[model samples]
Target: MAMNDGMSGPGSNSLKGITFLLVDRNEALLRSFQETLASYGAAVYSVCDISKVKDVFKEVKVDVFLADMEATGQETSALIRSFRDSNPGGSFFLLIDRVTYKDALSLIGPEADDYFFKPLDPDRFAQTIETALGQSRPKSNSLAVIEPYVEQLKPYLIFRSPEMKQVLMNLPRIAASNQTVLISGETGTGKEIVARAIHVLSRRAEGNFVAVNCGAIPDSLMEGELFGHEKGAFTGAHKTHRGKFELADNGTLLLDEIGDMPLSLQVKLLRVLEEGVIYRLGGERPTAVNVRILAATRIDLIK
Candidate 1:
């Protein structure tokens, strides 16, 4: 259904500067919706193929994603999961027709912010988007406390939520300490970005910040990846290789997805953390590393 081109009354530009991505198979609906949102001063972009959503996300910082669940078909849940994995910060709104409203409602959990039914009120839809943006906007008081840090992180992180501001408020104190920190949150929630911010605020700001994804490395090669290896230590160990620990000496080492590390390697990791020394593979002597360790995990290790 297409919306009329009637000019909205005063306060019509409530969505000014807001970026929106609309996903729907119906071209006519997309054009009308895009025009309505654009009239309200929103930068609107539409896509028919859900597969191109990720590409658009990579190219632009989308403020909100309005997706047509009916058009998305059976892959809606999986696509939403992928969106959360890649851009957990962006707001997601599902557009469902009356027939599948209940089914779409089930998809609105931590990942989705809200949902709207098909044949939407153009004014109401624009107002809803503006309201969501307003609610997530950071309060002045909270922003004041972390303004400097936020400024420093502008190039690396994009967040303006009170929850994130609260998290940032504790960063200064946390960065001052030499103790190891475990940052736990859902996937793509900017754990790595926080780790980098800590490094930037800490005394090790001048030193290198090295990050290693514990889950990405193979189990067989994980040990050598973290502790380095001497020449001929393994089949492909042609020369002495420096591991993440040594590379981050006098700096910060972020072990991302730490929960994925193998149990065998965890023991060694504990020893290294306690001793501040690493015994490289096939090496008799221990190498001391003056690196601060920051661990990030998506899983609940406490459980």
Candidate 2:
């Protein structure tokens, strides 16, 4: 039986950057899953030939393995067993056709990380895959956290002046915390470098480090650039964009040239910082984000 949601969004929300190996007997179904999921920033590779599973696993860094198995339970179990032997860290999900849903439950529910019934909800299916992958994700090596920072920030952390020394000394504590940082320095003083150093030391080191020049963007499009815009928010907005804040979710966002930011946007910026949410241009609902903000300014705004 053919099942599909047909040109809909991901089976779940936020499939961005997820890589998976999708296995199913139905060639067309696999292709559809690949196209639909890939359209939403997911890395999906369709595997119609189950016998090629070993070969596929060898080539892909698969985060999740989703198989549609209407075949014998014995074959399904054997394949899963072999898959686990090769990629134990990979998340597994079973897709059972409605007719065989009941019979497959016993094999799928316990052994697999998760299961989806036929006629899968694009959103729900996406959510299940994401959730299982997250749960089964390998724990990052704690010791390795400092390794990256040392390599990236070595050049910037070197300065003989007392003031620079103080800044470098306190950097680790600053980076370890989620507090908003205000960096003040003239142009060519490496303000952005400092911001990157802070991000490297933070838990968000693995996440995105987005920096935007507040003065570079025109006043007309500043808000839209910072907070994103809905499709048709304004002229030429063909599709919705995930602004710096959204792109930096669970990460660090550096708003450089803060002193040059227009007063009107500054007020809105403060509100977003306080509320931890932003309303996209021409959007009805406010989108929430968890972003570490780093602001840079050279001029004193006290006057």
Candidate 3:
């Protein structure tokens, strides 16, 4: 389905430039799946070779990763964790046989956002993918027409709050620039929704808009989570993982709850902000990221 013009605040379809990495050892299934998503205007890359998953990620800029759990199984869990650790910004899903739907849920648990059962229902799959994409899309500035409730949409977002409308009016103008934006608001104020509107209105709307919740991350691994780490960088590091900066190389990075970030990691984060480069935990090279940083905080950063 085509997204309404300017519904996402004046950009093209939210899916237009976003990429999907569809991995399955099964050629027929992978093709069928890709075709289904493609019909909905998705930019899907289907990969059949399991061994080359890393190669694809390294070369391609993908916004989401969808894998066949039935085909990948436990053998891929380590890979999944590794992927999650490195590319914390991308959304992940699993495709499983109907009989193993429960098994799929149990296997991936919180690791995966959702999964598709075998004999895939095209419409349902489309809806699920859209919802997941909405969740993944970075919040931009847009008019918030607070109705009794807000539903995800393409162009204009409906909300009932007049304050939100004022914010939306400014979005179009604000989106024209490429300066770093830091949104401050209370919980449930829809900081992300606003951020996404800005993304849709901005020049980089065609590129990926990745969100990373700084507060949701555990303090223990915050370093490895944002900057990634080389395999054997630490005790549990079995493989090289991609960090949020790497995943959002040319996209927008929403640093949610920046205030909650531990003081220790703040030093490293400041360097990234200033230098536009990240150092993997165990790796020596400082990789550069050309990303638009949009941060949200519930507290008064000025204070």
Best by lDDT: 1
| Cα distance off (Å), candidate 3, residue 23 | 47
- Kindly report which residue pairs in candidate 2 clash with one another: 11-122, 11-123, 12-123
Model 3: how far residue 237 lies from native, Å: 1.1
- Which is the leading candidate under TM-score? 1
Per-residue lDDT of candidate 2, residues 59-140 (tens digit): 8667677887774345788877777887766667777654554445555435666455566654445544443333233344
**Listing every candidate in turn, what is its Cα RMSD in Å to the true structure after a full C-alpha superposition?**
19.1, 16.2, 16.2
Q: TM-score of each candidate? A: 0.53, 0.50, 0.50
Q: After aligning candidate 2 to the native by TM-score, how far in Å is the CA of 208 from where it should be?
A: 0.8
Clashing pairs in 1: none
lDDT of each: 0.76, 0.70, 0.68
Candidate 2, residue 81: the lDDT equals 77
- The order by descending TM-score is 1, 2, 3
Candidate 3 lDDT (Cα, whole model)?
A: 0.68
Model 1, residue 93: what's the lDDT? 80
- Evaluated at residue 73, the lDDT of candidate 2 is 48
